[model samples]
Target: MAESPFAWIDEQARARRRAGLVRTLRPRPADTPLLDLASNDYLGLARHPEITEAAARAARVWGGGATGSRLVTGSTELHAELERELAEFCGFESALVFSSGYAANLAAVTALAPHGSLIVSDAGNHASLIDGCRLARGATQVVAHADPEAVRKALGTHSGPAVVVSDTVFSVDGDAAPLTGLAGVCRESGAGLVVDDAHGLGVLGEGGRGAPHAAGLAGAADVVATVTLSKSFGSQGGAVLGPARVIEHLVNAARTFIFDTGLAPAAAGAALAALRLLRREPERAARARAVATELHTRLTAEGLEAVRPDAAVVSVRAPSPEQAVRWAADCREAGLAVGCFRPPSVPDGISRLRLTARADLTGGQIDRAVRVISEARR
Candidate 1:
């Protein structure tokens, strides 16, 4: 028999197994019995009755998917309305929706950082932002995580068009970037600042206006933000919010926007509904933050090594990748669903159990989660 052309696949699989880094999908049923601490639904609106009804209504009115790209046939009145509300709520002059948050990041980075431009990215940004920097035409220099001085130094090295990119709230450690300091450096250097607020929208600022709004940069002309509807908004899509001119430029120049199909109508509708719900029930945001603080405090008090959450994510360290996986599995067996982060996913190569705090989680549930996690530690 001829040697298989894809023999390298088996070798890589073996390597992953040896390194305790093999990953597999575990599709969840519609009605899960386990207490969820793995999802990004910070406001607990993903399955809300109002959100579901809006999704159904939009599907009935618009269909299951967007028919075409925004430039072709997919721009609907619903999309326009969502954009308007998103911009206003986030204190931006305008907003542009995309098929996913990843797409939005790619669009914002690639469109803004043209040839000869320099992109100073934070070391601990989300993968989407990292990929965006890679895809952009400009050169990217990664600075130390959460260091404003490093950003300033990087900006000093370049004289052409430059933009500073970072996550408002990092996903792995749940640490927040110094947005005010970054903005100050950008202003001093005459560079634009682009941030991904995926983890901040429903958990930070006054009534969850987001990290940028909290830092007094939301409406600034020199700043732009990308956010995911799948998170706080409890839907499936992403958007770029900024000054009217920057958004207009993205609509005209961003390849992701020009070629990719528009965001689904149902997602747009559902996100809009969730936004309205957040507006009416602003306490949900505070509750989500409180839950995170309680989880971190409880876990740490129990002698667990965990990062102090800046938003709704709590990251607990594990001794090794194998131990992290086993810990997560044990927690799952004990009726808790937690996120397990391992090598390649974590930039620092540290494995940890990631827990997401939701607004709807009760005090009893929080205590139960803490107990389960403490008992399940490897």
Candidate 2:
């Protein structure tokens, strides 16, 4: 019995290293010049001059960080304004912002599912959602990926308060869930449907209102949605949106929202600016989807096993995890930075090279990226 209680950590680390799964943070320089296809800034707004400027101004005006927990001193007019605009933009009755999309998912899943409730989750959801399910108080049934029938069957077995949780668009494969079908299944079971629209907002629907809006479930009393500002808003936060009553419940009951510091003023300001920009120039959202489609088409034509995108993400299968990692490394060497997804990021036990399509990419950039990717395959 070691007093430190950390003696086994080294063994696990060595095991992870041998498995080629040890992850480390690499500090990126401001002037690093790799062509990015890995970042989630689908709208290409993360480094936009206006967005950065707004962030700078906010930090100067409101200080460098949120001073306290949102329930205490962290809530500000900026947060309130962003919440209002986000809810209205996405057609929800109310919205509550959290520190990150991960936190938002945790809050939503835990707050909505009570001790005796049931949670029906999709197998292909993001890791955050999967973790949220694990943290939830209710018993969770992981249904098959995007199978409404599976959802129905799971709900049939449970006769309590149930919630069907899924990502609007599967992150790894970039394939969309049958939201309409899932909603119908939930409707029959008297269950609420909770969607993590991380890859949908600012990349789906008219003006990127999100998949919930596209499926006509945005303001539905039985539906709740979560979104991330880091992806399309080019900011750093997440939100949960739903009926006013649901939001009220989250405000009081969601531990993440009440205990964590409010999203920084700079992020809130930048996200607000981006949202307004998107409202004014809605084509950014459409362009992102178009880029994703074109990338998939070109990759498939070049004899790659790329998944046809449902949003701004494009995933091409690789032979193995090591090969996938090497392929991505080669791409980086070729001045093209792309994402490499391996187990357990991919729930299907398949590895992939994940490419994010930026709305701002040019024709030449697309061609170059395609060439680089094709050449890097094992």
Q: Rate the local accuracy (lDDT) of all candidates.
A: 0.95, 0.93
What is candidate 1's lDDT per residue for 216-327, written digit by digit as tens?
9998999999999999888999999999999999999999999999999999999999999999999999999999999999999999999999999999999999999999
Residue 240 in model 1: shift from native, Å?
A: 0.2
Per-prediction TM-score to the true structure, in the order listed? 0.99, 0.97
Per-candidate total of colliding backbone pairs: 0, 0
lDDT of 2: 0.93
In candidate 1, clashing pairs total 0
How far in Å is the alpha carbon of 82 misplaced in model 1?
0.3
> How far in Å is the alpha carbon of 148 misplaced in model 2?
0.6
Candidate 2 residue 211 Cα shift, in angstroms, is 0.7
Best by lDDT: 1
RMSD per candidate (Å) reads 0.8, 1.4
Checking candidate 1 for backbone clashes, the offending pairs are none
